[model samples]
Target: MITEFGLSELWEPETRRDPHAFYARVRAAGRPVPQVDPAGNRFWVVARHADVLEGLRHPEIGHQLPGLSHGEGEAERIASRQLISLDPPDHTRLRGLVGRAFTARMTARLEPWIAEVADRLVARARELGSFDGVADLADPLPVNVIAQLVGVPEDDRAMFRAWSATIVSASDWDGSATLAFAAYLDDLAALRRRAPADDLLSELVALEAGGDALDRDELVAMIQLLLIAGQETTVDVIVNGIRLLLTHPEQWRNLRDDPSLADAVVEETLRFRGPVEIVPPRFAFRDLDLAGGVIPAHERVALSLWGANRDPEVFADPDVFDVHRSDVRRHIAFGHGIHFCLGASLGRLEARIMFDRVARELGTLRLAADQGDFRLHHGGLPLTL
Candidate 1:
């Protein structure tokens, strides 16, 4: 039998095209499965919805693998403090600080601007007759929105994009890209301090919550997280959602007829083809029981968001892409517990507006290439449309 990791199959480009069927097999097993990584590290995969939830909230599981990076450099140490890589206390404090900067009110305020961006992209697509949704609309939308939030100048978005792409590269193992990114953030931080602006990064710089403020290294990590995460996964969501809708014509027609269903479509798209295939690896801090098995201390645990979202026990007709899926909201596409995505509201807002504008402004969207031709970024979602 294929290991659950094989089901995820990060390496085989063809397998990345559709890992759902493999995830379905894991779900059919109805329990956690152990697997190995390319680095020869062993890990457990929690595939069932209930098990994934249990593991996510398990106190003994944490983001760090002391076994893996016990002697790593300072850059790696600072990265461990990032929101995604932290557990409680620190995670709680940092989450509150960053969350305040991205309140629903602030996201609501961004609607008009986000809508304008979508409109402009759709208008360009109209001009070209047929365009790859990735380049024309999906990729640039979130990048520009995040750039605006970070106070990056309009003249510098391209340069910022290059810096972000390099820093986010899957091959950046030596931490050189990380050091370069930190250097850029250092310069940007000095500039922001000298002349602050009405932007998210400025708010982050001045952010003080629970009597604690982010230090310079923490600030760099936070900005790095926001830039790559704020833009990349969001871009995947938009591109994947569009690819799903275009391929599933009936669902697309259903959404087009009832634009109110755009919200539902977005939810369903997330469940069916969420941007992140699996949650970041969590280490078992101590021996712990999980879904009919024991995970030894210091072992790694990987949660399959893809598997949980489509578990047959939870969702009816789990494989079908239904726009009006009633149980769609139950999907942990944005994740669960305290570590849920802080930028979810912004992602949803961007997606809803883009879908609406496409319905109104875009003439017709056709997939420019075969689904297999679309490249998956380091086991993340497809990036071509």
Candidate 2:
């Protein structure tokens, strides 16, 4: 029995720095590992590769439950009402409206601009000779791109970036960032309602299907979701990829020799050192068998993507970071099913651009800090580049 406290024992700092050791312990434990808090509050963590995949796609699992919430009233509703927390018809309808906004055309149009952003960011990093990749390059790149896409005023982007960063770093316990972002989104949505423009926020504002449109609250939640989800994860992906390449010199060499390997590097990094430590806890819609462990209805269950991705059963020699690994793309870092990340393509494109730019600017990238000196950025995601 992995006590709830034991399974959740990894602190923010330690987990952020190196969670592999911790994950190994959990993986060695029985399926649907039990995690008990001091108060006897327990949750199940699914770490096996097969179980993680099943949990991700299972119809009996979802983000919603009647009484399961972090807090009472409006805050919980705001948190749950967002696309990430929705289920069924609501999820389907909202996904379609938002999906249309991020069409291939929009992505293509954003590519050159994204490349340009990467170039400028790289130049700035190069000028500094040495800089925190997460802060100087990886951090600002996606926020800027998303800002432009949402039509944020040039002068306000700095503030926009700050809020986005704060929210990403803020955990569920700290509701400040969430509240701050919600307030900001409320105002932005109002602006869009009055004067729609060519940007994504405006596009979403005007979007309608079958005579249905996103309500004010829904609009606010979607924009907040996009800014955080669209920008936050990609930052870690790029930062993690660069650091991995530098650490794995051979893989770095492969990428440097053939920049086309950037795509492979992105996929491998997402699998090996994924952005999220675990998928947001999904609730068991009802009693279900998972890895021989039965999860009770409405119980909170989390899938450790980091552990699952490295499951030996799924990937041979899973510990080795290889860009050329034939089965590298099979990792569920971006998730596996209906709730699979909507921003996956955008993230991959951003990471590819980041790697290509790094190779172009810094021929032989080297870590400025000791391997142990790095801190995790997006909740237990180690950051060093």
Candidate 3:
């Protein structure tokens, strides 16, 4: 019998194609594997919806893992300088300062511009007939939007996109790439200091002057995190959602018939094939009970957002991708609690506009070739449409 959370033979191709079915097997056991990895790490996989929620809500489980850094424990280098890296009182203060920048009103105000961008992209896609969704659609839109918000110039978007990619690389850090990125950011900060604009970066600079505290290091970290977070995962959501819909023609038709369903479809797609398959690893601040096991302090806890979203106890027919599912919003695709994604609203808006514009402008959009194989960026999604 396969023990709960037992290491199985499925880890290889599953990482390449789909990990959902594999997670279903573990979830069927109704408990996380007693201990998934070696090193006698006490962490358990939380596959049940209830268990995931419990783990996410637990106060003892914090996001302060010390050993997560690479290359001789570069703790000072990798930790996010933004609000996300901070735990409590500091987190609350920084988040409060930046909350107004991402308000619904502000995002809504950008709708016309976003729609225009979507329309232009869709028109370009039609001209090409077939394009890699990852490169053409999923990758660029969010990068463009976030660049505008952060005061990056139009010509600099390419370099900014490359920098975002390098910083978020799961493999070894590219020294030249990383240093160039850091230097660019330092220059950007100095530019803002010299002549501020009416963007979020400028606003942050002003805030810094007004006693809202964030040093140069913190600012660099915040900029890097925002650049990657604002663009990368969002591109994954759009690409993955499009891939699934194209394969499931019926669901695609459901959205085509009624554009109002696009929002719910976005939510369901996020549940089905979200970009951040797992939540960022967290540290056990103290001994904590999870999934019928005790996780000792100093150990790491990884949350499977993908697994939790598809738990049958919470979602009926969890494996089936259904846009009409009434419980779609219950999914933890955007996560829960204090560390929930800050740019979620912007992501949704981008998705809705992109889907609508694509479906409307490109009347006969479909997969380019059945035999073409696509690549997945570890913990990321890709599509060709």
Candidate 4:
């Protein structure tokens, strides 16, 4: 019977500024809170740690209801094929094809190069004496790493970064940036067909040519997911991790003294403030019971990862940012179940390397001034070294 608040409250400037306060109330309600989105679509928010975990793995819940038409627009058609938007056996098939490129071992192979990239970025920031964390270090490192891994040419990476920023930040698709990105990938695929390279895009292009493995739209969708999901969320993790450490001076000193604590810092940051407040919306295929409430058939269900990560029952003193927390691994910031983030290993590696290098090279750092609350896409995070 949680009826007082809904999605409108969740989207308010005040709530976005301090979401955990809203989430705390939702979790206390002891059930899935029903909500109506701005579009007037009915949905439910699953907030508790146990409930969110179960919702992610539930058999009756998915991206789309069973036996429903995919949709009938260019954007909808393309979006339906994305890794994040599909259910099994399509999800299983696509993840299998792309998973080879992002395996833990493959990610490990890139660590030395990733560390080199992090070192260069940190060294340049140190030389400058004052730098914006987002623009100088957090942004470029992942863009370069993921671009190279995806076979996007170094010369065109600036354009790629701009397109990503545009598309992700837009409230509505409008399809302008997406169309341009698809066209660029189309050209890149043509090039890879003529001259294969040692990268993921070239591999996908080969699969598409083989006839049975992939289609043109699926190929573009895969690359789009890899490029955007690969970099955007990781940027948040890195920048927010830095923001947390500087704000928590004692934690910053802890990492400064022991650079190896970078991995712990990444974990704690994900728990404290994950990049994704809610995972992309899921749907209830039939009337379903979860978290002591029932969601009607075909209704949208939003799983709040931020809420679950801070559940006090799961993480002791969950509000406090602690790099030494024993249960930090339980946080599902990258998600759980079948739709888990394909780039988790790579994201972790990149963040760990960047934090370690910042600790070793930057020495001591402080925020230049008050920059208000940290945002996913922000102007900058000015820091004085």
Candidate 5:
């Protein structure tokens, strides 16, 4: 039997810095822990690898659940615009269409451009001898790449960055953040309709141009969802991946010495500390037996990607950051099943380009400061990169 614990206590600075230890304690509790968030919504957080996969595979669960929320009373507000907050035929239809535009072939086609962009960024960073990984490399690379991919003009990328940051705030979506982003997206969607271009927005607009296409509201919501979903997580992956490699000199040396190891290096990074600590909340639609317990219908469940990836049952050491781990490919960072992240290919390509350039250009890169306790930003690492 597992002793229940408080969710708020788990959010403390010490826990945030070393959350894996917290996961261990929760796992040792023997079963999935049932808890309520600060907002009073009840949910089960599965902290062990086997349990997490079981929870993920349960058919009764969904991306959006009644009473499941981003934070506080913001469920209604978040649900209003993001496709992630929906389910079934509605979710499938929207996702299917967007998937057509963000296909693996399309994303892979952007690789050369991604490499060119990474080369430019590294050249600029090299001139300074050392630079912040997030600001110099992570933040700009994906933001610019996705911005261009989505058709936001070069000049408006600053606004895209600001809007993306606000929408993904780790805490809550309230006050000015809500109003400003809503207005910005509303206006931007209108602009895309008026002046189409060779970007994702234009494709969406063209879809809307046809009479039986996405409605105005769905179009706006989809745009907001794609922009935030596509950019923020990739930024963390690149920044955190770079931080992980630098901290582990052996891994860094391996990547630098052999350029072909870039792909494995990225997979290892995702396995080690890929961004997004928790997968989006999933709600149980019906009572389901998963790993010996019955999760009641209508209850909420969350799978900890961080915990599952570090699970000893699956990976050998589970804690050490090893690029050469044979089981690195098993990480569930991009999730599994039907709702797997649509942008995984693009995100992978982006990471590959960034790593390839880093290895080729910045030979023997080192962190300017000794790595400190990584504070969670947007619910993931904000290691000063």
Candidate 6:
């Protein structure tokens, strides 16, 4: 029983600096560890790879808890409708409608455009001689790609980027950014309705499923999920990949020697230090026995992606950052089951293009200065060409 550990510890500066040790302890306990967050929410944290996988696919666990009230407010209402917050039936319906517009085929067609965006960003960074990896390459690449795909105009992208960063970071405590984003989407939806364009927003605005279409709040919520999840997770993967390569000079050389290894780097980074620490909280619909432990009905459970990815039983030398690992595909950084990331293909395309460009064009990169310790959420990474 890992009684001393609590979910709130993950937010501590020291834990954020190096959380795997904490995860290792949880895994060694061999069952889900009961914990309460700062807000007094009691939940179980499932850490082992098998357990996490089971939790993800368990039919008894879901996002929507029965009898739970999703507060009534503009932001809360929009959040309630977001794809991530719903369960089957509603989740199935909304995902089906949105999926049509964000298909794998659509993502494949954007490869050339994504590569061009990467080339331009890399070229500019090379010309500058020194640049922040996050700002110059990682951040802008996904932001531009998703914005273009969603039909957000060039002029409004900067604002969207700002809003996305604010919302993801949870710095917009007053809900100002959420309201602003909702208002902007309202206007954008109206415009697309009046004159449809060859972009996702237009497709979504006109999308229909069994004589049903996305209502206003649903549209705003869907776009909100896409913009934030699309931009934020990809940014972390790219930046973390670059950081890993630069830190591991030998791997960097290997990638530079063979840019085809860019895909390998993306997979390895996700396994080694994936963006998400855990998937969103899930509720147990009934008392369930998992890995020899029981979760009471109506309790929340957090499936630890970080813990599962580094399970020693699954990945040998799990802590080491090697881009050539064979089992990297097993990592569920984009999550698993029904809530698996929809923008995953786009995220992969963007990261692969950026990593490939860095290897072929940039030649070699080194940190501009000592960056002390790495936190999962970082402002930027300064690097020199």
By summed lDDT, which 10 consecutive residues of candidate 6 come out lowest?
370-379
- What does candidate 4's lDDT look like per residue over 274-360, in tens digits? 999899988999889998889888989999999999999999999999999999999999999999898988998899999999999
lDDT (CA) per prediction: 0.77, 0.78, 0.73, 0.87, 0.74, 0.88
Alpha-carbon RMSD, each predicted model: 3.2, 3.3, 3.1, 1.8, 3.3, 1.7
lDDT of 3: 0.73
Q: Say which candidate scores most in lDDT.
A: 6
Model 3 Cα lDDT, one tens digit per residue, 1-385: 3453435323455543666766676677655554444444455556667777787778887765655553443224545555656777767776776775557776777789888888888878778776777777777789999998888989999999887787677433445555576678779878988999867777777776778756766666677778888888888778777777788899888777877777887899888878776677667788777776676776767678888899888898988999999999999888888888888999999988888776676546677645322333333232334
Which pairs of residues have clashing backbones in candidate 6? none
User: For residues 1-385, what per-residue lDDT tens digits would candidate 2 score against the true structure?
Assistant: 5434355565546664667766666677666776664565667878888888888888889877877654675556566678878888889988888888877777778999999999998888778777777878888888888888887887888877777767666554556666766687778777887988778887787765346678766776777777888788898888788888888888888888888888999999988888887887678989989976798888878788998889888898999999999998779988877778888888899999999888877775677765543334542222223
Higher-scoring candidate on lDDT, 1 or 3 = 1
Question: lDDT tens string, model 5, 1-385?
Answer: 4475766656667777788887777677766667677788777767777887777766678866666544543334544545566677777788877776666766766788888888889888888766677777777888888887877778888987887787677443354554555566667768878877667867776776565466655665676666777788788778777778888888889888887788888888787787767777777888866644666888777678888888888899988988788898889888877667878888888888888888898875876666565433333322222
Query: For model 4, which pairs clash?
Result: none
lDDT of 6 by residue, 215-334 (tens): 888998999999999999999999888888988999999999999999999999988888898888899999989856898999998899999999999998999998888888999988
Worst 10 residues of 1 by lDDT: 376-385
Ranking by TM-score: 6, 4, 1, 2, 3, 5
Scored by lDDT, model 5 comes in at: 0.74
Off by over 4 Å in 3: 1-10, 14-16, 34-43, 65-82, 171-175, 371-385
Estimated TM-score per prediction?
0.91, 0.89, 0.89, 0.95, 0.88, 0.96
TM-score, candidate 6, is 0.96
